[model samples]
Structures are given as structure tokens and as C-alpha cells.
Target: MSRIGKRPVELPSGVSASMSGQTIEVKGPKGTQTFTATDDVTIAIDDSSVTVSPRGKSKRARQQWGMTRTIVANLVHGVQNTFKKELEIQGVGYRAQVQGNVLKLNLGLSHDVEFPIPEGITITAAKPTELTVEGHDLQQVGQVASNIRDWRRPEPYKGKGIRYKGEYIFQKEGKKK
Candidate 1:
């Protein structure tokens, strides 16, 4: 049995969830997001709480029970409280700027890198060095953050380049003189 699956997810106010066939739509103050849940998992909402259950007692159903519930719970949280990913730009002249919907990144490369923002995602910079990605969908938020970080990963030598918030990088020692 899945412990998390058995627990009921309490929904916050100002969030609405609807199901149409395999797709589930969630609307909230931030924005609206939708997902296609697996057929084996069933979701129901009752009085500001969402419950997830498996269709049968099969092995696959049991295994997927908790996973499905977690996904649903995240969706509920996403709609109510926006998910954010913070990235820091290191090295001289390395910075990111938001131009309309495009993110122009200068990471010491031959040319400036332009990454187009996807729908339902917002990017904000607290400072010239820090970039924040916010969205309702967990997958989309994570993917965009990873894509930008991949452009210039932190090096062990100097720990320079873009990295996730609180991410650790072990510094390598330089050669002896």
C-alpha cells in the first residue's frame, strides 16, 4: 500500500479543478494548468480536498498509486502557490536579461544566447546575477531551469557559470607551483 496515496490532499482557496476524459485542468489566481493523468488513477475533489485512488488492486495500480497522488498534490500546490527556480550567474560579464519573452544570456560564449520563454512560465531577475523561473507546472519549470544551466555548467576550477539555488560544487585544487 502507498502511504502518500492514502493521505488526502487539502486544496487551497481560489483554485478550481476539472476533469475532461484523460485531461485534468487546474485554474487558480496565478494561472491555469492542465495535465493528462493515467487511466488507472482516478482523482476526485471534495470540499477543498483532493483524493486520489487506484482503479484496481493490481501490482501496477498499487505502485502507481502514490506517484499519481504526488503529481496531483503538486498540481494543487502549483496553482495555489507558484513554483520557483532560482539560478545564479557567475563569472565576469555573465548575466541574464528578459527582453519581452526572450531570455538573453551572456555566459562568456562567442555569441549571446537567447532562450525563448515557454507559455505559462515567467522569468524575473532580482539582480543582474540572479534569475528566477516561476510556473504552475513542475515539469516545465524544472526543464527550463535545467536548459539554461546546461548552457554553462559550473566548473570545478573556479565554480563559475549558472547554477541552481543551493547547489553545491566541489572546488578542485590548482597545480602546485
Candidate 2:
């Protein structure tokens, strides 16, 4: 029995959810999001709460039960509020700036890297070294932050690159003399 799956997801005030076959759609102040559950699980919404139940006593059904419930919960939360990811540039010349619909990154590379911001996601640079990614979809926000960080992952030796805020780099010893 999955503890988390047993708990129904409650819909906060101003948030609404509807189901169509296997798909569930949640609408709130931020935006609308939908999720389709697999046949291994069943989804039901009642009295401003959503629940997921396994179709049978099978491993796959149990696995899907928990996953589907979490997905529905994420949809509810995402529509009600936005998700954000923060990245920090650690190199001396590394920096980030948002110009129009593009994010310009200077990570000591040969040329400045230009990342085109997607329609639903927003990227902001509060400081040259600090960047924030915001969006209604949690996956999109995290993916955008990861894509930007991939340009210059922090090195083990110098730890110079782009990294998530509060991330710790395991530094290695320098070359022996």
C-alpha cells in the first residue's frame, strides 16, 4: 500500500479540476494543466478532491497508483502557483542577462551563448551571476534551468561554471608538485 497514494489531493479555493476519460484537467489562477493516467490506475474527483486507485493487485498498478496521484497533485499545485528554479554563475567572467526573449550567457566561452526563452517560461537575471527561471509547469521550469546549466557545469577542481543555487561542488585536490 502506498501511503502517499492513499491521500486525496485537495483542491484549494479558486482552483477547479475536471476529468474526461483518463485525462484530468486542473484550472487555477496561474494557468490550466492536464494529465492523462495510464490504464493501470483509475482517477476520480469528488468534493474538491482527487484520488487515484490501482486497477488490480499488481506491481505495475501499484506503481502507477502513486505516480498518477503525484502527477495530479502537481497539476493542481502548478495551476495555482508558479514554479521557479534559480541558477548561479560561478566563474569570473561568467554572467547572465535577459534581452527581450533571449537569455545571453557569458561563461568564458569563445562566443556568448544565446538561449531563446520558450513561450510559457520566463527567465530573469536579477544580478549578472544570478538567474531565475519561472513557469507554470514544474517540468518546464526545471528543464530550462538544467539546459542553461549544461552550458558550463561546475568543475570538480575549480568549481567554475553554472550551478543551481545552494548546490555544493565536491572540489578535488590540485596536481602534486
- On TM-score, the leading prediction is 2
Cα lDDT listed for each candidate? 0.88, 0.92
TM-scores for all predictions = 0.88, 0.97
- Whole-model lDDT, model 1: 0.88
lDDT per residue as tens, model 2, 1-177:
999999999999999999899999999998899888899999989988998999999999999999999888888989988889999999898898999999999989899999999999999999999999999888889998999999999999999999999999999999998
List the lowest-lDDT window of 10 residues for candidate 2: 74-83
The lowest-lDDT stretch of 10 consecutive residues in candidate 1 is 22-31
Among these predicted structures, which one has the highest lDDT?
Answer: 2
Give one clash count per candidate, in the order shown: 0, 0
Clashing pairs in 1: none
RMSD of each: 1.9, 0.8
Question: For model 1, how many clashes?
Answer: 0
Model 1 residue 42 CA deviation in Å: 2.3
Pairs clashing within candidate 2: none
Indicate the residue-level lDDT of 172 in model 1.
100
Regions of model 2 farther than 4 Å from truth:
none
